[model samples]
Target: MDSHNTLSARAVPMDTSNVQIPIITVWVVMTALAAVTVCLRFYTRHSVIHILGVEDWLILIAMVFSAGACVGSIRQTFFGLGRHIWTLSPEIMVQNGIEQFYNFLFHTMSLSFTKLSIIFLYLRIMSHGVQRIATYVLLSIVMACNVWVLIYQFIQCIPLKALWDPSVPGTCFPLAANIAAAVLHIVTDFIIFLFPIPTLLTLRIPKKQKIGLVLVFSLSFFVCLISIIRMVVLKNLDLTDVTYSLAASSYWSAVEINLAVICACLTTLKPLLARLFPKLLGTSMASGESSRPNPLPRKLQLEAPSSRGRPSRRECWRLVQVCVLPPRVR
Candidate 1:
């Protein structure tokens, strides 16, 4: 009998198996990195440049939402996330569900704000043209999508408490709703990732500055990739063991939002880098400004020599300094 019982126990899965450590570690590290980036961004804008635009403030708000999502993710682990659903008590399951709900809410708000920050940054540098009009249209779409998503997320279940407390008599949207949201999210990510390329190409800036801008904007594509990965992970998730199955999705979500935060801040950090590392960004950034709203005047004379008496050497030098040099680094 003893041997038979031991064999039966061995055949059963271990109740202690959980992915808590990995999930918590991912959130903690991503949140820390995001915090550092945001602090650096604020220092660059407020202390170094002494100009804080709406974009800066929007990014700060996004950081707060991202931090909240991180906290919610960690809290879920304590409430039976990353464990077998069968092993958790109903109360713990309900608590975990509640955390999951809020975590999703936080994630949505964070991305929305980060994208808004990026849109505003684009507007600041763009001139009055098709690029600006397209940006305005994108801005309207983002705002409308955010409002709809926020409302839908809150009301997905009638009698909100029923979302976590399944015993309550209420209805909730099907998984199809989640799939729709994820699809829209991915589409917007792609749009945002590609929006600035055409404008960047049209700008009559130096080749070097154009390259640098391309590289900085390219960083956001990573966030888009993370969002795609999370969608894939969630697509195959097993609701029967949701707590354990959702771990990978949660990890990618944390990474996606924090990375968005980092990218948004990084675009504004050129001045700080130029200050610290002088030649790192080249002469275009010598003045520590990154965007150029005004182009150099075309009528400025650069062909006439001092000997020709069109303009003295000193006078030409002054004109070049004021006209040719980038007021903002482009």
Candidate 2:
């Protein structure tokens, strides 16, 4: 780099600053993620057991939404007009960009780690002999490396002041640690996503069901892609002139966390889709022959009337009664 030049030199001495990102888009998606989780609960399997059944879904959803909340606090810390535009000068923007990068880094890596746990949960459900064992081994490695990366993320700088202000007296070797952790984390994401497919492909279920499982699980691939992309952005981001600029860091960081939330919600689609579009996910207490036999069939039987075309409480009660006992007299 440009070591001794004034323009390129560190200006702030030992004042390594407090940190800061896109607050709104991230919140909106996170809210939707929470709403879906709540709605899905009513779409139970064995009703009581169904609530217990989707526990993993609930945990994954919480992990992602909570991570967004962490980044959300940064906005509070980083936002006086002076704070947001802190040192708008070009050289200082470079430093700001680096700081944001690490903030985003910690947040997204935490998210990736949590989502992998959920994905492994799915792997356990779907895998058999060898695949199941392999998945467990892979996930162990993922958790270990991710923990290492997270520690390195915020703690790598000595005296910690070297994080935002190079003028601070300290030392660190974050490059190797960061790069190794990222590489392993990315690899684990892809592997978790892939390992399930072959096992899913071999299930004794019908063709349509098999295809549905494949498609649904493949959504995790999108999450994997986002992590990989973030990895690249972060690597180059460390070099950018405006590395701490909120816009640059916030935009992609939001993408990364939002994507994690989206993936968590997707895996749980069996429940959420049932809530939003009951016709597709099938109802718990519906009356009739069109049941998919896949546990929670849609509860779309009309009971009461609607003025604007939605159901009334009476309608819901009648539908429940019908499922409770078929109206057959033989």
Candidate 3:
């Protein structure tokens, strides 16, 4: 009966199975993503820094912070993971545990720095009235929440070795703490996304342009969704199957890293893309204006009109054209 059970229970062995290589692949992709993320940061640094004026200092500070974090994370992934996540020796597990802590710390910091910079840039872009105030408020909350999450992770276990070697004399919290943190992370991610949507819709740009901007943010939100799913996977991990738990976490960790890079890349690229591809966006915007004929001088409306007191000659002309122009001709 015991032999029968062992045979019946046979499945993939997480430790010996070739899972680490694919996990390492995720790391390589994440590193490349970080490289591009930094390049994008620099791309905006010149124009965004100047355009931002007095608020420019904030951009610089965010840039330095993100750069440090991204660069540090990339280095750690390149040199750190092989020794930390892949080794089989018990003696190495403790040091690997320390590396894992730093790895998570810097990655989270990098993500936070990059996100704050993106938020500041958007605030500058939409600088006026209520939205600006809201931007700062939302940012403060996101930053605070992220910092708290990091604190919880670091302090989740005392006498640190318990983190890697739970069989040692130290005691630690059950898995519930980690699960809760992952849930909070998913919540924070959605908040970052929803913060900009309504204000962006209020802009004077074309509806299609508004949609494009919204879609950019929506991509960020999508990242948040992926994060939430990753969190759920994290919550399912059980130490009862140490091999399988480690394997499952290894994959989810990569997903989280790549998603971080994606969010970082998109946010930093916003202003530059808008500037570079303005004409494409302008065309998309104009198409949404009105398929119905307008009653004005088309050429003049395309050029100039009234500021305030003056009747919009363009509107008057459009009215006349609508009234006078033959239906067939129109």
Candidate 3 accuracy as TM-score: 0.67
Report the lDDT tens digits of candidate 2 across residue range 1-330: 366565545664433342332445554565465445534433433342232333355444545555555544344334321143434554554455464545556564546545564654555354245765776687677677667766777677776656666666888765566656667767776776787677667754446556876887787787677767666655665343232433443545555555555555455445444445645544322433455433333333433455655544433322222222233210
Q: TM-score each candidate.
A: 0.84, 0.63, 0.67
* Model 3: per-residue Cα lDDT over 40-148, one tens digit each: 6555544432222232343344344434443443443333333323434555454545555665565566456546656665554554567768888877887887788
Q: What TM-score would candidate 2 get against the native?
A: 0.63
Residue 314 displacement in candidate 2 (angstroms): 37
Cα-based lDDT for every prediction: 0.80, 0.51, 0.54
Worst lDDT 10-window in candidate 3: 320-329
Model 1: lDDT to the true structure: 0.80
Best by lDDT: 1
Off by over 4 Å in 3: 1-15, 47-87, 126-128, 241-244, 267-330
Steric overlap count per candidate = 0, 12, 5
Residues 1-330 of candidate 1 have per-residue lDDT tens digits of 999999999999577799999999999999899999999989876676555779889999999999999999999999988899988999998999999999999999999999999989877666557767999999999898888888989899999999899899999998778777887888888899899888776655567766777888999999989998988888888988998999999999989999999998887776667557654543442345554333333333334444534643333333232222432222
Q: Is candidate 1 or candidate 3 better by TM-score?
A: 1
Q: Which 10 consecutive residues of model 2 have the lowest summed lDDT?
A: 321-330
Rank by lDDT, highest first.
Answer: 1, 3, 2
